[model samples]
Target chain A: MQSIDHHFLDDYACRNALRGIDTRIKLILGLGAILIAISADTPYAPLFIAIILSIVTVFCAEIPARLYLTLLLIPASFALMSVIVILFLTGGGVPILTIPLPWLTFTATDVAALNAFLILSRAIGGTCGLLFIALTTPMIELFSILRSLRLPDEFIDLAMLLYRSIFVIIGEAVAIYNAQVMRNGYSSFRKGIIAISMLSSSLFIRAWDRGEELMTAMDLRCYDGKFEILEPKASLTIYHILPVFLFLSLAGILAFLPLPFPPL
Target chain B: MHIMEGFLPSPWWQIWVVLSAPFVIMGFYALRRMVRENREALPLLAVAGAFVFVLSSLKLPSVTGSCSHPTGTGLGSVLFGPFIASVLALIVLVYQALFLAHGGISTLGANIFSMGIAGPVVAYAIFIAGKKVGINEIVTIFFAAACANIVTYVVTSFQLALAFPAEVGGFMASFMTFGAIFAITQIPLAIIEGLVIALVFKYIVQLKPEILIRIGVITQERAERLREGWA
Candidate 1:
């Protein structure tokens, strides 16, 4: 099937929605998914959810399944949380096997085999919910929700600046790092220091000037004390309600069901 | 050291996390003011945030394939202060949760408290102490980051203990033990974090004289002299 990552979706997906359901509707559904995925006792629900996610990614995101899988799935290797813990802890439900000589210890002979499957589904389930929200929502609209929610101005401001800066500052650091590689690479720890020095010096000077600029911009916008979200479109309707209920129902049903496969 | 789903029941983490939502809202309001007040600082904050984000995403080898990323908040804390750091981290955590699923939302309050509040407040206090004590600058930065790392984990452990009480001992004992598990990974991470902080600070001191003034590491008078001396 298709890869689950939303990051590699086609430009068409980013530019236009397949269904283009109301943001609130998608948001509600996605949030409901998060709760359901978290509560599910059995792993099958998550796997099913993952499969659904793949279908959505393929049709809605307009990305080729293979490329998406290669780019996103490969990097997803970072999801393993406790392969060692399960190996030594009876894999929770798996049978135990012990080793002796070096030190008397315990392990599940099938722990590796089981955990790989378990963790993958868990990560995929949780990940799909998040991707749905992120890919569908634009940054400004996302902030708009926080504003409508009556969030504090201070936190919003921090996000505003931090978000604006992520791309800028990263660009500078990359340039510095590129220069460093040209000279010595990170061949030695000492060389790494030189690269850091270059990065840090620019980091400070840039932040100071930008801080003053940001304050002025806030004053001009009549920012007041509270962070006011410019009123939303007020166009929400049945579109929002349906997806939310559908996703919630799907996840809720999964939470109560037992896994057909073994726990592993 | 991020806590994931199923580690603790949903009810506990959810209630605490939801309770803190207002605090986050208030924090947002405050940061908006800072932004309005310090528009010039936008580009700089971006660079700082990006520097940290990129630097943080780099994995450090410790126990085999398990890699711990730096929060990189030592300097962010030292310069921005904990309140602002709280705002910054809230954004970062939210993005990470929604995008990467590296941490949990039910633990957002807990995350902010540990990484944002604990690290910055502790790091700032120590840094100020070192400066007042007239300790070496590089050492001060390194020491502050090192202390921050330890304190952050200790606080995070307490957060975990609150959620998951072990059967072996009472809640408090279990809390301490839970904190200890992270302390194991954090110790080496702290040392490396310290080294990185020291190196970055040292490099800044050498390459960009203007930053010293902006960050308050040097007074206006000192900055003038440095410029005059160079001239």
Candidate 2:
């Protein structure tokens, strides 16, 4: 039997403390913070949002700190690589440091360092904002929110079907892969290519078959060409809405204020 | 080739969002029409979208001995036309952003534009041109897949250049810098993806030529020829 954790973030979203909070509020806070963070000039606001939102996710939402950090490492790695490049390649203001290499000399400028820092902080803040939504609000709630927002019913229905199919197809792909590995299907470069292609093709056939079954089932049920969305049980309360509003406003206000510290 | 969240700051992200919206809107209409024409197409399209997501998540062995994920958009565009492929890619990108933390919500517009719209459009165009010119089916599939993968990265590089031009050399130099970084990892992966997708196309032709024919991916004559050659 698969544990609840088998579904990864979805499991957490279903069980989190903030899960009962209205999704619209969560979305607003998350997206509002993201917009503020990305558009902010200094690193302070984004860095603040990053640190605060992370604490909320880990403590308030009760997400595992280790898992959260590990998930964060994905975007962090990309940010680090790009920031290093920007630090060395982007030139402005006073020269900060110069290192000589065999092929080329690298120089870091004050402006470049600041720019890189700003970008890195923004990336962190934005990721935290996104993860907050991912961890606290399940995709089902999001779909309902989209529905309420008056998105096309057909599009929502299709999105729901696609979402459901992803897990089924992933399970099939995984089982096939394990079987392939057991049979030494990926021993060599050529063999590996063939194995992967075979895996993909078989998976494609499985999806096609699954699609047909779904259609038949829907038809049997007198398919109305629309899916009924389970309205999110969470109700709008001042308790939920107020905090998000206050937090976003705080982040927004902080975004415009100048930092007290001197320039690098 | 996902640009990390908040990587595109200010006007750049907004610009990409604006530019990508039109294509996505068109894709949405195309999707609705496809489903309306034949209700059965709805579930198949959904599953096809899921297939694209799963295909991208798989690790492929590259020439450099390192493993990477294929974009999977080329095969999608070939199987479903570019318009529907764009919608599928959009859904996949959203899922990846939410579940995998591999991409950011803020940059979804840019990512959708690159991996979803531009790549599929190019792939479909290449496949059509290849067929029109009577290119070898296998070779055409390879190039279509490979070029789609490469073009996604190239467009990403272009977005980066536009966002952060180098101080000395401006857009051209920044583009070269980003392009070089992408080409190093991406070119090899693209080649591997091309080869794998070509093989997958071959397998599909042999096993389920009817599906391809139904989808208008290949004519009955070509499917017959492919089946015979493979057999």
Error of 1 at B19 (Å): 7.8
Candidate 2 residues lying further than 4 Å off, grouped into runs, are: A1-7, A101-103, A260-264, B63-67
Candidate 2 structure quality by residue, lDDT tens digits, A153-261: 7788888999899889888887888888889988888888899899999899889999999999999999888888778577889988888888888888888877653
Candidate 2 lDDT over B108-189, as tens digits, reads 9999989998999999999999999999788999999999999999999899889888888888988888888768779999
What is the TM-score of candidate 1? 0.76
lDDT, candidates in the order shown: 0.60, 0.85
Q: Estimate each model's TM-score.
A: 0.76, 0.96
Residue lDDT tens for model 1, B1-231: 455533334575676566556555555565566667865444455456645655555454333334466777777777766666666666776765554445655456667777777787798899888878877667888998888878877876676566545433546755665555556677888887787787666655556656666657656664455446545
lDDT of 1 by residue, A85-124 (tens): 3333323444546665575444455644464456455656
TM-score of candidate 2 on Cα atoms, chains taken together: 0.96
lDDT of 2: 0.85
